[model samples]
Target: MMRRWARAAVVAVALIAVSCGGSETTETTASITDPPQINRWVTVGGIEVPIGTTDGPRGGEWEPFAGFSHTPQGAALAAITQSVQLSTASDRNWPTILAGVAAPGEGRDLYAAHRGLVEISGTDPEMVPTIVGYTIADYSDTAATVDVVQRFSDDSLASSTTEVVWTDSDWRLHLPSDDTATITALDAVPSELVNLEETRK
Candidate 1:
């Protein structure tokens, strides 16, 4: 079930996200701060993802998906929010979500073409995965790499790494040139993961 959703939903548009290798350099300009506590969770496509009322997304023109703070926590939050939005986007909302959250790039253009096709002919995906937690892989003022941990109904876990850049005044999703930078099945959720669901409870 999770596999089917991945192929139809996430994989179809998930290609826009940047790769794991290049562009994740950690900056030494300042110390990394702890992410704000999960004060709430907003359900998207039946999945509940974290939200920190005090720290950020701070809100924007895109409402839930835009205007994150410039802090590492803000970047992390933006990554998680956009990852879920991209994974769950359907024909009705993909374009708006893409425009609102993604940085302008060739990768995003290619993804829009592919996603438009899916919207035209593909069936709406079922079994969208739920985000259980996340980890910040790297961070800097200009760019960040966030690994989002998702949990299937069958209890399997995987990490979906996304890159967000500080574009204009807010964090925007940075799509890479390739589609191979998405999810990786995990033996277990990492110990370092800031378990959102667990913490909120």
Candidate 2:
């Protein structure tokens, strides 16, 4: 996954985030799913997440197929970009990654992995990872999917995808169900959790 490799880099937040090798693409592409009007910004984990559909918003905007899947893909890109792409390896980043994951000990495991990545990469002031590109591989009304490609300073490129769920109020990383975390490109694969989530949506 993009984040798996990102956590091992020199603190993703320091990344310069450039489009892989292709010309940088913006959100102006007309889509059948485009809304009548655009929202200025949306709240995610209390942070004002920008919309990439105009003026080529920078920062946490995960340069991907925005507005294509609306809430699902948009939220996935934001969280992935913020949590993994430009991560500072700070505890503050954990809450957003853990917002909707109610698994008893999942946060600790993810945090530990995150810390390990930072430690492995150490700190490099000159380090900057390039974001090649991302695609919303597939999606459904309740599910959003995406694939992000990035290149670290070492010249190694990695790609990963994640699923996001619209919890009515916010979009969260769609985690593996309690029974089984097995997931596929088009589906979440059933888990032990009856409702997919341990708690109500």
Model 2, stretches more than 4 Å misplaced? 1-76, 85-89, 100-128, 176-201
lDDT of candidates 1 onward, in order: 0.65, 0.36
For candidate 1, the TM-score is 0.77
Give one digit per residue, the lDDT tens place, for model 1 in 1-201.
666545533532342242211122233343344655677777665456677764455442234376566677777777877766665666786788787778888878877776777643332334356667678888878898888777665566678778888876777888776655666778788988876676655
User: By TM-score, how accurate is candidate 2?
Assistant: 0.43
Residue clash pairs of candidate 1? 16-175
Q: Give per-residue CA lDDT, model 2, range 25-91, as digits (tens).
A: 3323343232222234443322223344432124332332122223433543443444342233334
Off by over 4 Å in 1: 1-33, 58-64, 120-126
> TM-scores of all models?
0.77, 0.43
